[model samples]
Target: MIDQLLKMADGPLQDLLSQSGMSGTESTASAIEDTFGSLLKNKAQSGDLSAIKEMFSGSDTSPQSPVIQNLAGDLSSGLMDRLGISSEQAMSLAKTALPLLMNFFNQRINEAPQANEDIMNSVVKALQGGPGSGGADILGSLLGGGKGGGMDLGGLMNMGKGLFK
Candidate 1:
């Protein structure tokens, strides 16, 4: 899923990195993914699933929402510190990427009726430190869980694929 998001964000991420006087798209992509994953994991670990819920709930897509804004701020600060970039450059990258990520989740929720439920369930499990003890399990289960009573993992991947095209 991060791979698909990185592919979809290639052009924009490249532009952001260049503007920040940075190069190496692969590293930048990794940093973005790392920061994003960390944010979710930290929140989940702390029993604060509101952010994850908000992002995947499909109830709101506004980038200005406090939840997304807070996430962007954290991501931007992390990027600035990690990449030695100006706050403006870091914020620019965050502002751009956060919306795209949220949009991706919103799209998935809209595309699959069971997506929100499954995501919520997976997130709850992740918070309980299930399996890998992070959002990885939630994402993995959401994107790789087999067919049963809910939407298949392949269908979820297809929904994500639709975002890039």
Candidate 2:
């Protein structure tokens, strides 16, 4: 699922990186991936379905909520410091890439009912946070079996690495 999301965002992300003069760098790509992964993990840990829904709804024209705004700000600062870009460029990249990424997920969910249910179920399970609390387990189940079978953590990690590459 992470791989699919990253793949979907690759073109637009590349374009954003290019605009910031950080194009074609694997480290930059990895940072972007990490930022996204962190945000999703935080949301899963929080167990707030409505917050997650609002983040990915793709229907909010209003300003981003504080949680998202803070994430974008932090991401921008990190990118700016790491990649030697101006703050404006970094913030622009974050602002642009985040919405694009969310919209991609929204579109995917809307287009596939099974996938939508599976994702929501995974989110709920992650919130439960007991034996199978990790995002890898949730995403692994989504990728492997929709029946909530055993998680392949290694496989999920490898898939995430491959996506960044």
Candidate 3:
């Protein structure tokens, strides 16, 4: 599973590695693993897994709500800028992170001795229906109702991909 994640993160992670002036090799792999492991551990301890999935995939939970879309776009852009990642790198990272992260978490969640379908279903429902549905509203409120407007995550992602090249 780690191998698969490494494969997924390879492209963007390689770019980040290069940008950070780290040479590509086993040593770099060790360093990268160390960094990612810390992040994963932190998120696992304090984060919601389904929210992470929604973040990466840009899936719409509420068709009538453009709020999530806008929120996602702003979050993506802000994160990219703050991290000094190019748009392309961010997009690729999103593309890679969501799947790789999801698989990793799903595996862990599954392997939990007491894991059950009911728990998983509840999680999925919450992701699709609860306060999670208010991502757009929460983000909008944070931005103070500025005019950046409904998130065009798909367009922004494509833009990032284009910018990278």
Query: Which has the greatest lDDT?
Result: 1
Please give the lDDT score at residue 155 for candidate 1. 59
Could you tell which candidate, 2 or 3, scores higher by lDDT? 2
Model 3 agreement with the true structure over 1-165: per-residue lDDT tens digits: 123233444555566556656444344434444444333334434543534443233233442234333333433454465456677754444443334434434444433332244334323333233222222322232234423334466643442243222
The worst-scoring run of ten residues by lDDT in candidate 1 lies at 142-151
How high is the CA lDDT of each candidate model? 0.64, 0.58, 0.39
* Model 2 weakest 10-residue run by lDDT: 127-136
* Tens digits of per-residue lDDT for model 1, 1-165: 333333555566566667757668667766786787677768777788767787668675687878777888889988888878899988887887777666656665656534575656565554445554223353455534322324355755664464334
Off by over 4 Å in 3: 1-75, 117-165
The regions of model 1 sitting more than 4 angstroms off are: 1-23, 113-115, 131-165
Can you list the residue pairs that collide in candidate 1?
none
Report model 3's TM-score to 2 decimal places: 0.32
Query: What's the best-to-worst order under TM-score?
Result: 1, 2, 3
Question: CA RMSD for every model?
Answer: 5.4, 6.5, 16.7
lDDT of 2 by residue, 1-165 (tens): 444455566776677667768766466766776666555656667764554564444354233755557568867877787778899988877776666566555554544433454555655454444334334365546544334545476756654453233
RMSD of 3: 16.7
